[model samples]
Target: MNYIWDLIIKSERAGIAKRDISFAVAEVYSPYMELSLESLNARTAERRVELNPYYRFDHIFDGMFDINNDEDVELREQLFDILIHFLADIDLTQGLNKREFYIRFALRDLENGAYGDKVMRSIGLFGREERDMIALNLLRLYETGEAVYLLKDTMRKVFKRSTIYANCEEKDELLVYVGQEETEEARAKVGLIMDIFLPVRFHVEFYWNRHFGILGLEDTMRQDGIAMY
Candidate 1:
């Protein structure tokens, strides 16, 4: 109706009262516009039923899981409705998330109706931190396994202690100078990360360079796990 009035402005007369004309036009146009809008919405919802998965439209997921693909027609319909409606409670939005990503992955994969049981029992599979770690591992899967790069960038990220040094000694040994503050857990993780990102030729050794011995002197005495400062 407002649009009709806007169109009428372009054809308004210089000196005439045509408010009555607008009222009559609107009386005819408003119902037609309302009906057209409703029909358009209905058409859009119908499209979503074929292209998307949500609520009643979730029948798009039929024959997806093993239960839905099996010969038991009654069981398939029951389980498909039950599972989708249950997961619908977790996310009601008609948009994609991790849940949708898995669904799409299963759809595109050739292992049709294979991972249904796993998806049902996949309580610990798609946590945010877990997915983030998976993504990071994939991104760094091709990092150069060089010693200099390890000392420059990789070790800093994997180790807690900031003050550290690297040395290429004779006999194919790489000497690492580290503080006593680093924990054994951190040390082990550093070794694992280095093993993944270091060439196999170099033997890595960690020397805790904080003085901790009976002499208690810097750069001289040696203890069980501590070396010279």
Candidate 2:
């Protein structure tokens, strides 16, 4: 919980501001793959009752997260509940709906990491088996922190911004142009342009809090797993 506060403050300072604080909070609390399978299984049980007040099989069949999309009523219910629990437990603010929040944030994370294609392949919320497998693999990467870093690196490459200064008369207006050259050298040393590595400072500071916070998450790292330096 202390880590939660630190993240809030860090994000607040990093241009996140108060408007999207709940979203940031939800992102920080989201569980990775290292969490026990039993936790997810337990959530499934609880979700069944909450989602299906009537407890009817046919009506809620389409809502289940299944590979086959078959009417396996029992398994479907369990899957739906587990997914719901996984989503709800992340953040429980009054205005936020669990399912909607998860889907939206997941999309943002994917976009930030340039993993949109991988996420699409996983079909996580869309109920596809291949996509589910990819999601599981990606979760493993997240547990190791490699996935997060991988996404960060991709983001640095994708939305890399630059500033250019041109010598002009006092009355001359500024002009901006997009680069058309597809060469590495051109991309690297953009003429009259000052290149700066823009770090997503919020993520870095939030991770610092995550590393030092007393969540036992850092301690769970083995030599084979992720380690904070």
Using lDDT, give the best candidate's number. Answer: 1
Q: Which portions of model 2 miss their true places by more than 4 Å?
A: 1-163, 181-229
* Poorest lDDT segment (10 consecutive residues) of candidate 1: 43-52
**Residue 49 local lDDT, model 2:** 23
Whole-model Cα lDDT of every candidate shown, in order = 0.39, 0.33
Summarize candidate 1's per-residue lDDT along 30-88 as a digit string, tens digits.
33241112233342111111112222333665335443355766665456445433443
Q: Tell me model 2's lDDT, rounded to 2 decimals.
A: 0.33
TM-scores for all candidates? 0.33, 0.17
lDDT of 2 by residue, 182-209 (tens): 4443333221011111222322211211
Query: Roughly what TM-score does model 2 have, to 2 decimal places?
Result: 0.17
